[model samples]
Structures are given as C-alpha cells and as structure tokens.
Target: MRKGLFFLCLVLYAFSVTLTVFVQHIGIQDRLLKIVCTLGILLSFFAVLAMLFLAFSLKGGVESLEQKENPAEKIPSKEKYLEFAARSGLSRRETEIGWLVLNGLSNIQLAETLYISLATVKKHLTHIYEKTETSGRKEFAEKVMAFGF
Candidate 1:
C-alpha cells in the first residue's frame, strides 16, 4: 500500500514537472485556466513531497524497530523508567502510559490501569510513541529497556 502510494505520487510528480514546462510554452491566454493548471501542478508536486517525507520517516522508524529488538534486554524499573521519560520530555500522562506499555501491558490493560477509555489509552500511546521517537509498542518497549540498561 505504501509502495503503491509512493509510486502514484512519483508518477504525478513527474507528470506535473513535465506539464509545467509544456504549459508555460503553449501560451494559453485564458487567465483562469492558466491559474488552475498552475495550481494543479503545484499541488501535485506538494503531494509528492509529502509522500516522500512519510516514506523516509517510516523507513527510519522500521530501522529503529529492528535495531532496538533484543530479547536479552531487560525491562526498566519504575523510578528509572519515570526518570528516563522525564528526560525524554514526555507529558505526565504520556510517561504513565509509557511506563505501563514498557511493562508489557496490553492496550485494554493500560486503559483499565489508568482509568481511561480505550480511545484515551490509544491517544496517550500515540503521544508517547511520538515523544519517545518510537513507531509502535514493541519498539517503544525495547527502547525503554535499552535506555535503562
């Protein structure tokens, strides 16, 4: 799915670049038509740039996950985990969620533990993942363990 989106963006980007050159030379006199064409080309290019950015970010995230995976790594203790989360600049809720997540808690368990709804748990997890620079739970857990170790 990602690859298909990327390829589509690439094709559109290339077409937009080619269109820009050709459209400028054709000398269309209709002001509205010219504006629309220019806008379309620019938007296509922007979409392509966005896709490229996401692709690279996802690639980095996948690499990070792979690098952090180690069964031998130990889980972090409470005080140490909180300290690390503080250093990592997570919010109070995010730190709590991160700690629970690091302890191998399921999402439902996290919600129950924190007295939050499942949606709220997911929301906090997203924030925690972003602040911790991790892509998902497994990577985040490994990272926390690695940090403590």
Candidate 2:
C-alpha cells in the first residue's frame, strides 16, 4: 500500500510538471492555462497529502507490532537474577547456570554457551536445585519468582 501510494504521487508530480511545461510552450489561452495549472496543482497537493498519510499510518502500525512481539519490557533484568543467586547462597558457577536456566536456556544450550559438557550442565543444575531446595526447572522458576527474584 505504501509503495503504491508513493508511485501514485511520483506519477502525479511528473504529470503536473509535464502539463505545466506543455501548457506554457503551446501558446494556450491564458484563462485555459490558469485553469489547467490550478487543477494540476490541486491533484499534486492531494497526492502528496495521501502519501504522507500512508507513510505515517504504516510507521505507526509497524511500531505497534514491534511492541506486541517483544514484551521484554515486563521481564526482570539479569542483575536481579544475579542478586537472587547471591541471596540464595549460590556459588559463582551455580549462579551462572541459574541465570541461564531462568532465562529459558535448555541444558544442551547452556552446555554450548558455557563451553561445558552436557553432564557438567546437568551437574550444575542439580546443585542449583539442591541449593534452592527445588525439585526441577518448574519449581526453581516458581521459587525464584515467589522470592521476588
């Protein structure tokens, strides 16, 4: 829609310029030339206005979609998780794993990201679960949120 409006505006502008030049060179009567020029100017003005309206509306729609798709605004920050780990008596490695888990990384992904083996990632998760007195991922997340982490 935006591209179409822009193309329409371009065509109208070109036509207006061509009509003005042709009217001037062809020795038309002054009254007819004035009427033609006025009509052409009005058409060009409306085309520009339509293009501006489409551009702004499309921009607004894209911004709205971005906000809807991202909702990260409501999620807590990484620092909050770090602080939660500290308060929960987690060691540095456990805290690191906890942060990744809380952010929704899988054990395999965590292993890849931290450059550790899958067994090592599982071991860290077990330690975090034990330290937080939680059974698994779901409970761990619930506990952290309950504690205002």
> Compared with the true structure, what per-residue lDDT tens digits does model 1 show for residues 1-149?
77777777778777777776677789777788688678868868797787878799779989998997654346767877888899889998888788777666799998888788999999888888888899998888778878887
lDDT of 1 at 28: 74
> Alpha-carbon error at 75 in model 2, in Å?
4.6
Q: Give lDDT per model, in order.
A: 0.81, 0.81
Candidate 2 lDDT by residue in tens digits, 32-126: 78799879878878877877887788899889877674323333577776777888889999988887787778999999999999999999898
All candidates: CA RMSD in angstroms?
11.2, 10.4
lDDT of 2 at 100: 75
Pairs that collide in candidate 1 are: none
Compute the lDDT of residue 101 as modeled in candidate 1.
75
Model 1 spans > 4 angstroms off? 1-73
